[model samples]
Target: MKKIPVYLFLFLLLAGCSLSNVQHNEELEDAIYLIVSDENNDKLSLNSMTTFDWDKAYLFTPYSTQESITEQLGVDFKDPSDIDWRDDIYLLVFLDSDQVIQYAELERQGADFSIGEKQYLTPTDDIINIKHD
Candidate 1:
């Protein structure tokens, strides 16, 4: 009846809202360029995954602490706010196929860094190697 139709409409509306709010992580294969930040706040552009040291890479979740990120990046911060993602941290920037820039905070592991929020680790050295122009 009318009550059933109203309930159905309300359910669809809520479902659509929730779906829209959910963020979808971009696939690594969709990324064209990987930009990394150095300790001096300098940026390095890696056009291909081959340039990245993958043997020492690992995957980490985004649920990390400010202290942990600071320690991993080998930077000192008296306050969490003192940590700048653009400079004081190791960030892995992914320029996706859709021209959308996605980023993840990186934690150094010896010679290589672990990417955060990435689900799987694949040998990407040979996949996409387009240099950023």
Candidate 2:
């Protein structure tokens, strides 16, 4: 009976330690953002894309851009590992100070750009014009 309790305690302790690897960021500190399923969002490399990772997900925070992505390659994400993200465009998510979340896709149409259709978490009466430089 004593060994049973000790094993139970050890199992619980190890399980808690294993759960520590889970990462989650609930706050945003930037005007533009991108979320993807990958670590190393540290901006360690420029234009260096990492391989697809389904084990973990990461979000790019506080990003702004002057250029844009005008076109997007149609993808069904059938094989997430094989999905090719648009290098010229980004799915910029705007989280206003009011915590109003808007989904916008930035596209680079030559020298000009456009923001994708706006979406909201809840119904809002205000116009959402999420612009970037």
Best by lDDT: 1
Overall lDDT per candidate, in order of appearance: 0.35, 0.28
lDDT of 2 by residue, 21-44 (tens): 322222321212342212223222
Q: For model 1, how does the per-residue alpha-carbon lDDT over 1-133 read when each residue is reduced to its tens digit?
A: 3356888999999997854421223343233223322233233223343333332222223344556644543433222222343333343433222221233444332223333344323445222111111
Among all windows of ten consecutive residues in candidate 2, which has the lowest summed lDDT? 68-77
Q: Please, what is the TM-score per model?
A: 0.22, 0.23
* Candidate 2 ranges with C-alpha deviation above 4 Å: 1-4, 24-133
Model 2 gets an lDDT of 0.28
Error of 1 at 10 (Å): 1.2
Clashing pairs in 2: 30-62, 66-133, 68-107, 68-108, 69-107, 69-108, 70-107, 70-108
